[model samples]
Target: MSFTSARPEDLLIDAARRGDVPYLQQLLADGTVDVNVQNGKGFTALIVAAYDDQVEATKALLAAGADPNVQDVSGNSALMGVSFKGYPEVARLLIQHGADLNQQNGNGGTALMFATLFGRHNIVPILLEAGADTTIRDVRGLSARDLAVQQGNEEALKLLPQE
Candidate 1:
């Protein structure tokens, strides 16, 4: 990504942010815009769409061959973003698109950790069912269940596997 503000990548990012499917498809068809092009923050269109809860845009991006496992500068994948945001549908989309359920971020936080820490109970099961490892610990030596316990997220705690 260059410093140019008017670049097609910028437009693509904005289009995904707004869930503008037609415009997104048009840009993808132009062949100049890389579907995985990242902004200054290393956020691709797919990451933006999934984080913003744009289900259709996310699906379109996946259909266009977006890498669901692409991480941001912080090593946060689209799955982690949606898990924290409580977008269950978006989470499922990424999972179906081959998102790594247990991929950790720079902080060693997985999607399950984010979901549990953020009170996204719905995402916890989705991740667990997809085979997320509860034993994975973050930089703080906290697992998803530990986060749920700290956050007092009873729903998440109940859903989590016993240690």
Candidate 2:
């Protein structure tokens, strides 16, 4: 069956979470399912795919014109979700697709900060090279560097700007 706006957003989101690229493409083929369509939790297919590290699915959603910067109820974007989860491949895809590197959540936490706090060393440099602002502080006044220090993330600390 062809998709319509009436199609359940969760179906598409679930497909993304599951890394079901074929089903996702099928749903998007009709161009009816908005790639940015959010479920009750405010997760779009792109967000789900990125958070779950479904590189192919993420690519499909972006190709389908998903808004990479769209944030969830907590103001977490696809980039931030991937960062927090330590999905470097997904982070790279999101970055290459023009996701905002400095977009913060409701707590003012940037992707870099999450990567730092979570000890996602692999993603820290990727985000920095992509121009994520290390100066931006969270609501608690912690920058990515500070978070790195607080979390004792030596790997991230070494890669972070000394400023």
Best by lDDT: 1
Q: Model 1 TM-score?
A: 0.96
Tell me how candidate 2 scores on lDDT: 0.88
Taking the tens digit of each residue's C-alpha lDDT, what string does model 2 give over 27-132?
A: 8886767878998778899988999889999988899899999999999999998888999888888898899998889999999998999998888989989888
lDDT value, residue 52 of candidate 2: 85
Q: How many pairs collide in each candidate, listed in order?
A: 0, 0
Residue-level error in angstroms, candidate 1, position 77: 0.8
- Candidates in order, TM-scores: namely 0.96, 0.92
For model 2, the superposed segments whose C-alpha errors exceed 4 Å read 1-6
Show pairs that collide, candidate 2.
Answer: none
lDDT of 1 by residue, 72-151 (tens): 99999999999989999999999998999989899999999999999987888999899999999999999999999899
